[model samples]
Target: VQFSDSVSSLGIPLNRIGTTQGVTVSLQSCTNGVIHNSGWTDNGWCGLGSRMFFQSTGTHTIRAQVREDGFMIDQIVLSPVTYLSTAPGKLSDDATLLAARVPVLTSTVQVGIGTNPSSGSTPLSVNFTPNAKLSGGSLAAYRWVFGDGQISTQGLPSHVYQSTGTFTTTLVVTDNLGHKASNFAKITVNNPVTKPGTLTDTFSSGSLDHSKWLASNEPAPGSISGVNYGSFVPGNVDLSKGMLCLRLQQQQGSSGVMSVGGQIQSVVPYSYGTYEWIMRTSSTSSTPNGSGSRVSGQVSSGFTFINNSQTEIDYEIEGGHPDTVWMTNWTTVNAKQYTSATLTAPDAGFYSYKFVWTPGRIDFYLDGVFVSTHTVNIPSASAYILVNHWGTNNSKWGGTATVGVERFLYISRFTYTPL
Candidate 1:
């Protein structure tokens, strides 16, 4: 049995008239879906609602029950109490079997680019249509739940979705009877933001392209098609399968090789938009002077007022360690110097790499973790896509002479968006 009490009733007392029967009660407050308070209370695994939010002068339902052996004791006596806004005697003089009715409401929620919740990391908001009780009444309130296990106890819920994909959302409501009506909303989150026009490279099975990547390496002739790549099967990228890849086989080219990567480009140009893409690479070649002869890729992502030099960024996996990856950002059209970051990883596992390019801001990521960011104002310019295997020409990366016995820099896929 359940009863309604004053909104300010801190806690209501319930009676279960059985000594051996185990009783259980669950008090669910209107929330988004996160379990803050236990909602259960007892001396031993049945009483846990000592600190839930409750207002005064409002009706609440108290459910009482007796459990014999994990099952409810139907014949057991359950007594519950309730409080009301007005006197019970005057509920309605002509009312015979009064049933509580709430207002009918139409609700609508919105997400930025797409509807699926699982696509890319981005900001999203939810709004509801007008909601009011039938003519003389008003809706008590509305509550929402994020499939990721969060609760928003309000009429409208706003949130930044995590990652990308489709998710099922729930909206629950409570009226004066402690009665509830729930509705579900389907949402999909996708990164509709386009990528940098000059950035080239597709993910593969430990390599980029079908071993068709064009690279330059005289000191170490860069090989294209090999087995040690990221994608060994076609269509490995999607919601279910594998990730993108970029591979580079230790090259044994001529004495001084230049450009050494396979390039990919965007279909359109973006002046001051945010650009994003997830990348994975490992530096396990352990070759000599490997740092100078980078297994690197570059691009020009965004532009601004003084942004004259094309925005250039790099993903370099040198030959020295074959297990560490270095990322670099250049002031393509603004600042003249270049900024870079070096990170280590778990030997043979895949990690996510992200780059966000804006007018005065250039950010870098390693497996979604922010490592470095820059701010430089510059004018936009025509950018080109380029990837290379320049063998040890600059001392900035001078370490190994060769990129070890590795073959092919496999590339899986590329994505772009502003978050």
Candidate 2:
């Protein structure tokens, strides 16, 4: 039995009740699928005494069945009483042959709010689209609350904010039956500001600036793959000919199971900034046992690291697909990962890879051309900049390196400017 009540407490009646334990009843609030257990009670099998409190006043479903044999029921009693005490059964006067009827509504309303160009200069033009997921319901209207006191009835409208601040945007969806659901997202705006002086290094001095870079030698977390392996090799980082080289090589071990790579991290942590780097990647040519070419499986990446792997943004290039670049954004709250479209890589030569990180968004660019923008799960903490080339056994990411083969990624220049 399913019904809606403005208040809690319900009266029920059962007939042909056995002396033994009768049926057990279970109720569920369909709104959130919460199950409420109502234990066995023998109050003459029909009374206003068996009262159950609903956690909420929405639609509910009730089910009853015999816990023992020889138990039967005829009908469920509906009461107008807001509260019920230990009242005696009035079966003959209150019992009915039918249960109260309520409209069978299985539909639900859901809304998702998304914005384009989520963060930019003041007076930013943003198009808000309410992605509505309506199941078995007739949508009557869409109400958009822009968080700025402005309202709109249009389903999907483009609104331009003429201010510089973070705004909470919400969308409420209503069904014909007056049921409503809402979802919210944040929009950030900032006044255009000049670039705050950049720190650039070209590695022409033939040695790492120890004050700015740190050599990281730690075990890569195993959560990404099934096994935890790989460590930083200090010898692999070479500064020669005005280029910083990160080399990846398979370590000495039985069965070709271990490998080592190079990693470098900036000593200074950054919060919101534009990070850019010019790099080209290459691997040694090879043929596996004279049959097919064995391509190197190296992961060359530049990214910002806050505390964990879950709170970072990355610009990664894999040796398996030398011409493809991947952009990723992650948040530690839900461990949600947002990835961008497959960006075409340069055919030959070093290319510019950059990402602008703000309070509410992160934008990716390749060779000074806009690649993609991600507005969800933006990080808001200081993070150190890192660059590395590594080999992983995880074939999905970067295949394990072949035994005794070396792969290298070169960075001609790197720069960062606070925004």
Candidate 3:
């Protein structure tokens, strides 16, 4: 905006003329197009309360550029203006402008903060988002002070507070006009309940590493009538398309006795850690003409097994109950304990199941979210990791496996981290 006047100072008048929330205006000398002053206002008309300065001006074009949307100009007023040598031409606050320039603005930008898992044990990880609204401007900068002396400038950040106590977190946002607003939130951190494990596995390769895995040729335990036991078939266990596919195929023995399924286990053993699997499963009901009797579904599982006293931790997807998952831990062959929850069947797609084994407890998770924690009879001995697809003779556990039937389980990735 250019104006011709004898007035020594300039006020290029501005207003919020539209519904668009944020609008910013910058005033600069037309001679060199250098910005002299800029400000933002949500309300209409001279909300900045300040004037632009130019040295000894005659007829000058003071450029008014909309740095943000929804700002409108009414007119340029030439008034007598002066600059203090102390602050130079730097932009002043609304209080300073009210004392030296036009009427004061009624409001400033509003800032707010939101967090996820807002409260948890110490060493808690929290995710925060800033919600700052500006009428005549956009966010130019962000400052986050996480109550604990740590700071960040990211719009959204995840931070882990290592100590236990209550803290007040603060956020400050600056607009294009150099206006700042602040907001704060309280986070309560308690003594950490769970520590992280040290081992992790994400299957990114096209084939399973033989050095890490071995097939199980033994029959499933606690066998029932009308069900065939499983033996490991190397060809049935394959890694292709970045997934480990374990298939249970009913095969007639050379003596004509049909086998139930297949299984694979880790070559190494882990005593205590966090173990996880991303997988899916598929099965079918037995045929009407039972060359051999088969049940409706199969048992697909990811577990840890030790033969010493037969210690185990099981993430078993029982086929008969399509949507339910069973979590079981055993200290001996005869002593078994379990809990269950319903989940969308993996056959529909992929799902994540995990368990954290500590000396005194076992924590279970589904898709990175906590599900259940078991404190009774947690396995203390190291065990080999195991994955299998098989059928039990009992209809209550796993539907019986029928001759000429097949079942499949696909594991895309397995991750283990020792605490």
Candidate 4:
């Protein structure tokens, strides 16, 4: 018999069922022009190995001649050296059955799942990737369960979360040998506030609107802008006297005197817009002076913020300078431009403080009068609108707080009109 294939070796399965005579065989390699002879005698079943050294990988031929009649010869197997090592003898009449009886070595399949942007506001888009590893087998299939009643058969998939909830995404993979592996990842989605073309809040309802605002609650004692003695607590914010009040209070704790501040931020973000606040600071001075009755050592601010990027635009009134309102804009925390705008009566009554944020510029106004304009470091990213009242011990900035005094910043109205 002659055979031609693209292999480096062959496995010959032979069986002797009813004969005791030995069989002589000769294997001649056409490429190497070499002939090798061997005798097979004591074989109920066994795979005889032969090697052919071809200089390159291409078609080659081998010829086999049998010198006996009583011995039975099964099909010759074209295989590599590694496969022929485990090749078994004739197990059945089918050639495939003979190869199937060989024991194969394989390793466990491992699947790892990965997701990008795992948490965000709806409708959030997330990208998922799978890392599959296996030895002695190839990956055959991939299955994904997106945790939203949706399934996929793709190796890499992107999913959109339309509602608000935490979801567990799963990936299951199978190898060519039917070995399976699975992994999972968790994703969180939040409902975002609806964006309005124009908005107005008067605080006349006597309660903070849950749909529009979120009061800041920093219960951990920490510092902000070097004010190390206090934290911003949600309890310090309230609706009273037909206005939104942000209060600052001081109390003696085990560590010593501690302060609490108040803050509220808009739920939806704004980009180019006109933002306004009709507000006034609390007065500790009994006599009204030309500089107004604003208390020293406190800060009242209305600003726009992108927390992750540190982008901001500010209108801050520092009680240390009762008559000055700092107007500022920033592209980053390290990049900023600011100026002081003098106010005639910052604590006596409610006055409109507004900022017109447009492309390339931010124009500030106090009591509807144009105060200043900043053309440098104007933040281009959308940010949340926020107002806060707090006290600091930094004398040059907010000054040391009066230990027993309770301060407040009252806002009667706030509005935003998008441009």
Candidate 5:
């Protein structure tokens, strides 16, 4: 988007990053290609622990190539329009309430808004879409700030509302034309307000690393069950930093009576404990088409947690179901499998899973809260930790899925040192 060939500036963002730090910038010819030169440099913006830079200016056709392993550039637009000021639409008393995964406060009265250059009583309120993801809407062009007693360019921003009485807020906005406007969205920012976890758990050497936890593979199926377990994958399970990364590769064929794709177990398996794992699952196997006898990946076979006490406590997270997580614990009398919890979209991003076992009850947690819990210790036998990413008999666990091929659980930190 070249505005003026003589002098123009483009706003490009780093979409993704490769393993390397350096990125390459290229200039191509475009229809409006009458420029002296075009190139890109670091703009100096960082997000999610990623370091990136922007170019000073751009025109014609510009492309950025990352020299390193995991660098990706997104929205490399060549334009002359830069963000001058944002549209400070209706503000709120507080905006942070709607931003948290689990809102600490349940009331909408606490959301606040402030002006850019707060002057007087500004209308700091905003209208939002249904279910109000926050207190504001995308009505404004540039931004609809819920200010932080400071100036910000982002829209629908959240702030650390005051703890005592209501706070005086002023809402402000700047249009793309560099024109500025101001308003006051008032409400009370009182106590019981929460902000992003700004304070890391103060380290005193006792704080453990997030990559130290362990994970295991599933148990081998039996002959009577016709379950084959020859895919003994060593080095597939790893514990580092503080996470349990599980990666299993089951060969394509079965080993006759022995079977293929063996089930590996976790080195540290206990009945009663809290466990968290961030898993990314994908398979080299083909996805099942809806035509014939379908074949999905063995996501269930990808990762499994068993009761080390033999009570048959199991948390079988499979890609077979995709959205739902199946959990079951064995009963002392019968070793029948049961469904524990089935959730939605269980195969994306980082998930922190937890399992808690007591004398007669067992529980499972995803992210943080307990999704489902099973009462009565089943099996009554000794079990171990297992994480096996394998293929089923003709069609592995689901047969048509690929996320089960290489499964990894990135455990950040487990606070089993219960107080």
Candidate 6:
């Protein structure tokens, strides 16, 4: 038999007829100058294996010679040694033999993305299209990781970048054979447009509005004014009785006492605004320790923050001193200024607390009355509005927690007016 393409090995099927004794046959490959002599005692067909590596793409020949009179030749088979190791014994069909003889050609797998308008201003919406190619394979899945902590599994996905920054969007594709390929695109967003508007949430819906706020779930627990303790968890936040409630508690863990806290922050950053909240500090009345004595070791806060730079403006009440509210502002972690305002009844009911922030100064007001003003260290950057209730170990500041006790901070309303 002759082949125009390369042949790595040859298979010869032979049978013996009208004889019980063995019949011998010789199969020889002319390309590699190798011969294989085989014999079969039974009457049925049998194959002889031979190695004849043909590296070049040219004509190859295999010659068969009968060594016994009873031996009858069937058909010649060309196959690679690697394929014959896994092929069926009978060598039944032409399609199976063809697949074994022809080498599989595999091209490189690739993935890419096309964005509608790659760069734009803040609050930009862009549609994405995935371009993927795989030779002899089909794409099975698509995963998109948008730079701003968002992900999608759709092939064609649209995303809105709310803040101004440079984001790298990536698309990962998986083929049917479990091969993966990934590609990335850079998206630039700038020129933030601050629309003058008002945002008010009264907690009337009996649930946290996802459109405006995101419940905090910190990856690990951290210390604020004391020892390393619990972290902010979304499970601790509650919206009921037309108010937002933040819970602080201690639970028994395998490692010892584990503290759990609650927090929520606005989805979008605000700049130059009057931020107001009708809220009350956490008290011992909610704890097993009962009222009269303040809930120690806890700090309840309503503040604005830009985390990367630690720029902030805050109104915080220490559970150890419920009658005093700390008003502070920070341009950075080291540069800060603060003052204390006396509260008439910190745990009795919700009181109006507000701060008007401008580029030059920030003024604090308690129950519509002027409390304090900060002329220096006023943050000029846009920041998220956050409310949190957490425990600390600092004796002079947050004090020590009464283990297994729970404390709560209640807020009836929150309003933000663009200045």
Give the per-residue lDDT of model 3 (tens digit) for 189-259: 87644433444445457666777778667775524434344556677676654567777666445443354
Top-lDDT candidate index? 6
Q: What is candidate 6's lDDT per residue for 1-419, written digit by digit as tens?
A: 22323333453322222223222334333223222223112112223443344545444444444546544454444544332333233222213222335555344578889985677677889899998887757888999998999999998999999988899999999988888889999988998656547889987798999999999999322354334466889988888645788888865555544678899988888889899999877864552123534566778899998764456999988766778899999977888989898987677777898999988799999999998889987777678899998876557777666677777888888999987
Residues 1-419, candidate 1, lDDT per residue (tens digit)?
33343222345433223333223444222222222322211221222232223344344454555446453322212222222222222212222332454333433331222122222324555443323333223356667776767777766556666656676777766654444556666666665544443333444344434332332223222322321111122221122223332233333345432323222333344444433443333343332113322333211111121123345555555544444555555544334434555555322344555656666666767667787776643323323333333234233342333334332222334544433
TM-score of each: 0.33, 0.49, 0.47, 0.52, 0.36, 0.53
Please state every model's RMSD to the true fold in angstroms. Answer: 22.3, 13.3, 21.1, 14.1, 27.8, 14.3
Report lDDT per candidate.
0.39, 0.66, 0.65, 0.72, 0.38, 0.72
> How many backbone clashes does every candidate have?
117, 0, 15, 0, 93, 1
TM-score of 1: 0.33
Q: Which prediction has more favorable TM-score, 1 or 5?
A: 5
Best by TM-score, which number?
6
Candidate 5 lDDT, tens digit per residue, 1-419?
A: 11122221234444323323233333322233222322212221111122233453332233355546544443342212232121111121211222213213222222234332122112222231111223333223334433445444455544444334445445445443444444555444333322112112111233223333232233444222334343444455444333444444443334333323433443433434443444433333222111112124444432334432234555555545556666666654354455555555444444555566565666677667777656644342224444444444434344432322443433223333221
* Whole-model alpha-carbon lDDT for candidate 6: 0.72
Q: Weakest 10 consecutive residues, lDDT, candidate 2?
A: 285-294
The candidate with the higher TM-score, 2 or 5, is 2
Off by over 4 Å in 2: 1-197, 221-228, 285-294, 341-347
Candidate 3: residue 79 lDDT (0-100): 37
Off by over 4 Å in 3: 1-204, 222-227, 251-257, 284-295, 308-310
